[model samples]
Structure formats: structure tokens, C-alpha cells
Target: MPHLNLTRALTAGVLTLVASQALAHGDVAPQAVDTTGLPAIEGDWLTENPYRAEKVGEETWQRAIEIGASGYNQNCARCHGLEVVSGGLAPDLRFLEAEEYGDEWYVERFREGYTQNGITKMPAFGELLGQEAAWAIRTYIEARPDEGALDDFAEELKAMRDQMEGYIADASGADTEALKTRLTEISAQIETASGAPVADSVAYRAANLIDGSAEAFKSASEVLTIGLSAAH
Candidate 1:
């Protein structure tokens, strides 16, 4: 009788544990995100986001953000929290700025996910959902308001301006027209905005120019990289 009772108790315990695990994750299957009507991203996967307003136009970016918000709610909100807010279970994604610095980590995690003690903490979403959905979700997360984002933007703008000036001064035969135009536009936008919360349009434009220019100007790119890490 004693051995029989112990066996029954162990079976009940296993059932309880299974129930709790199911409740924790809600659904084990990956939620589908509708990426219909979004621009196609070529190749297997992009290391960086290609949905910035500057890269794909404001209209397309708006569409991406809408799809991304819905996708995030369905897939990421359970662990990452609604609107990119974290409730201590996962890292707050709002702090992941919309740049290469954040992109590297986000892409890696989304593709491979995390595991501990042979248990899967985050299941890999790359195979189930393609790059378009991933980039769209990233766009939405980056759009969320963060505490220090504006201050970081201001500092970065100043550094980019200074770097552009240096680049102009040291130019030999490179076509600096595009770089000069971008720098001028960014400086004017920064000067016009006079508060902590910079306007979204201004911020987006500045970030686009800074990111786009990084390929041509190595020094400025380094500064932007360093600035992004510091901001995070």
C-alpha cells in the first residue's frame, strides 16, 4: 500500500509540472505574422534592418511598423512584454536602438534563440518567420519611446557633424557632395529642435544619414558604433 501511494503521488506531481510549463509559455507553436504588402528583402537574411524610412520611404516604413506591432504582440509580448516593455522576464527591447549596434544582437537572438541547462528559453523564430517579419518587429521596438534615446541622439548628431567636418577637411578626390548635404540637413534639423524629446521625423532622418554614411567614412562609422553602445 505504501509503494502504491508513492507511485500515485509522483504521477500527480508530473502532471502538475507539465500543466505549469504549458501555462508559462501559453503556446509552443510560433505565431504567424502577416508580412503581406511589405517590400521584399533579398537574399537569405540581412544583418541590418532595411526598413528605415530613408531606405524604403515613409509610407513603406509605416506599413512595416503596423505589421511589426501586430507580430510582436502575438509572438514576443508574452516574454518581452507589450509595447516592448519588459517585466523582468526578458530584456526591455526599447533600449535596443534602431541601429547596427542593436541589430547585431537582435538578429542573432532572433535566429538562434537562447537555451539553458538543456531547456529552451527562447525558441528559434528564424526558420518559422522570415527576415521581413523580424525586421518589421525590430522597427516597431525601435519606435517605442525609451528614457535616454533623445539625449543620445543629440550627442550622436554633434559627433557626426564634427566627423563630417573632419572628413571634408581631409578629402582628396572622393565625392563628398552627398556627405556634405546629409550633414547640413542633420545640423539644421538639430538646431531647429530645441528640447529633450526630439521630433520623430528629425530623429529618423538623422539616423538614416548617419547609418548610410557609415559605409564611406570609417572614422565617423567608428564614432557612431561607439555612440550606439554607450547609449544602450
Candidate 2:
């Protein structure tokens, strides 16, 4: 057999990590995509985005799914789920960025965290995986079928709302202009969701998603309308 080169070896290592992680988190399911007519995995794996490139057209989407699946399983399954679904213990990785934040938000959280509140368990992965590797992981998650572009946009909106709530809480003696900026962003989200007025319970849940006061709760409604509109 031809000897495995360093790149091949690294690719193998990456795949193995995803497989183990998915299995560990109970996210593993039978391959969803049909691989019967797909081409074999081959050649250098480099692409515009290394993480985004799976195995090329032979397997293409399937191969990408596998690599992403495995990588996510290894590094993220523990918290995000076997297949990016939520385990109820941690935020659902599939719908996270899809529902409340954008790629930049996800990237920032990957570097920093949900908030500086010190109450969340999410740890920054900047150290373990260089930015490229992190991006790869993100690509894998994004490739999964669970999240659509709208979902991605919605996720970003929610992140803004959550961030705004935090700002409102800490704004007592803080910068008024900053608060205004946050309000503007929040209003945008509300506009997006205007048609989808949430049920009282859902609205309440949405309200509680971020910590704040009665006044802040009122503000969240205005922002939610913008988010809802944006989503539509």
C-alpha cells in the first residue's frame, strides 16, 4: 500500500475525532445522505476553506458531512449534541447561530463566550483549535441540514437581543449612546419577527432568555418586532 502522507494522516486524525465525539454524545445517526453514487475520497484536501472542503464531488456533500460530523462529534458533541442537536444540557449547536446570532457572533463566542457574566459553562476554543480549525468546525456545523440561511440569520438576531438585555442591565450609570446603539440593533430584530408574534408563554420565555427588568422587557418587545421582520 502507498504510505500515508502527513496531510492524509492529519485528515484521518480529524475524521476520527469527529466520529468519536458524535458517538460519545449520542448524536450519531445513520448517514443521512445517499453515498451509493458518490465518488471515493481522494487527493489533497485543501480548499478556499479547509474546513469547508470535505472529499470533493465523488462524495462531495456526503464526504463533507462525514468529516464535519466526525470533527464536530469529537470536539463539540459533548455539549452541542451527537449531530448538532441540543442535548438539553447545552445550547443546541444546530440552531444556535441559526436562531440568534451571525457567523461573526459565533466566531466571537468561539473566541470569547456567551457573555462575561461568568455564569455560563461555554469555554473558548481559540487555544485548542487555531482560527482555521475553528472555522472548519463551524463549516461542518453549518453544512448540516438542520440550519437554513434564515435560521442562521435568526440566530444572529436573538444574540443581539440577549446582548441588549445585558446592556440594559449594566447601563444604569454606563454610556447612554452605547445603550442607544443596542436599542437600535434590538429594534431591528423585533421588526424581523413582527409577523410571528409569539404566544404569551413563548414571549415570556423569549423575554426571560436574557436577564433584565420590566422596562427592559418592554424594550425587548420593540426589538423583537424588528428581528421578526428581518427573519421574514
Candidate 3:
């Protein structure tokens, strides 16, 4: 058999095995989660079943937490983080708790995927992973700590933005010729400090928005802004 044909046959065989396993079991029960009443999961069971925390379960809570931890590592660790710290490709799942959004909010997000406010990177996993498994992952992740590094970076970036805004206001209000000279000098300084392509660094990118032609710059700014927002 040809290599391509062999590869295809192997793929089909593995999928067939998975399908058989799925079909062998009766459908898993849908878990009932009470969003309004509970505090965050803190590495302990909020209920008898930690994984399906809101539902009544025969399984011990520790066993459920274990299943949930394993399930999250398998399905979510890639884009989110190894320990729910966030890899910068997606929003930190920890935000679900710190932001004080409920389990139902997290569950609905996983099931429906976020589309409002122009955010769409998170695709719905409802079809691929059933409801119980999805909720289990959410329950597990709720206990992880906030990734502190990101908060530090956010503060630094905010300071930079404030500085940039001050410079812009000064330049805009002052003498036209002198303002142009100062902006040029500021742009050059930013380019040097950034250590990356001007277009890539946040400071230079924002500086470029100030200096650039209205039409071209605004479009680029929007794209970059949206990309950065999606990452967080």
C-alpha cells in the first residue's frame, strides 16, 4: 500500500475505535450547575462531585476533581496554560473567577463561544466535547492562581500609554514646526528603545498611529488593537 493510503487507514482505524467507545456507553447525564449561589473552587470540592460540582454525584469529590484536572490538561492546556496561567493566545481562565463571573457564565462561554463585542477567537467546543466534560474543565480551572506577570506587564503598558498621550497632547498644542521636530525625535527614541521592528513594538506602533496618515494608520491601529485585545 502507498504511504498516503496507509496513513489514511490508520487515521480511520483510530477514529473507529474512539467512536466505538463513545457508542458503548449510554449518554452521560447533563450536569446541573447553580451559578448564583457558590463561591469559587479553591482546590477543594464545593460539592460532593467536584468535576460536576453543581450536580448530585455518587463519585467522591476528590475523584471528580482529579478527572477534571486530567481533562483540562488534555483538552485545554495548549492555548490556555499548563496550569490555567494563560499562554497569551487566549484569555486566562482564571479571569472567570477573579472577574467574579459565575460557573454558568464559564459553561456558556465554553458551549457557545464568545462572539459579542467583536471577540471571536474562542470557538464553541460543545459538539466535540459534551457538556459534562466541558463543565468539569471549568470547575477544575477555577481554583488556579492569577498569573501575576500579566498584571505587571499591564501596568507598564498603561504607563507607556500615558506618557505617549502626554507627548501627543504637548505636540498637538505647541508650535507646528517645533511639534513636528519633537514628534520625530520621540518616534526615533521609541524605535531605538523597542528593540524590534517599529511596527511590532507597542510604543512605536502607537507612535506610528500618531504620525501616520489618517486612513492607512487608523486601519492598522484597529487591526493591531483587535489582535492584542484578543490575546488578553
- Tell me the tens digit of each residue's lDDT in model 2 across 81-108: 6545544554444433322233555666
Model 3 lowest lDDT segment of ten:
191-200
What lDDT does candidate 3 reach at residue 60?
A: 36
My TM-score estimates for the predictions, one after another, are 0.54, 0.35, 0.36
By lDDT, the candidates rank as: 1, 2, 3
In terms of lDDT, model 1 sits at: 0.61
Off by over 4 Å in 2: 1-66, 96-101, 114-120, 147-232
- Residue-level error in angstroms, candidate 2, position 176: 66
Residue pairs clashing, model 3: none
Clashes of each: 0, 41, 0
How would you encode candidate 1's per-residue C-alpha lDDT over 1-232 as one tens digit per residue?
3333224433443344344443233235678899997998878778888887778887788788789989899889986777565555555666554557567778887888765446666778888888999999987777664445446356656665556545544545444566556544553343211121222333344344443343445555454554445445
**What is candidate 2's TM-score against the reference?**
0.35
Local distance difference test scores for all models: 0.61, 0.43, 0.43
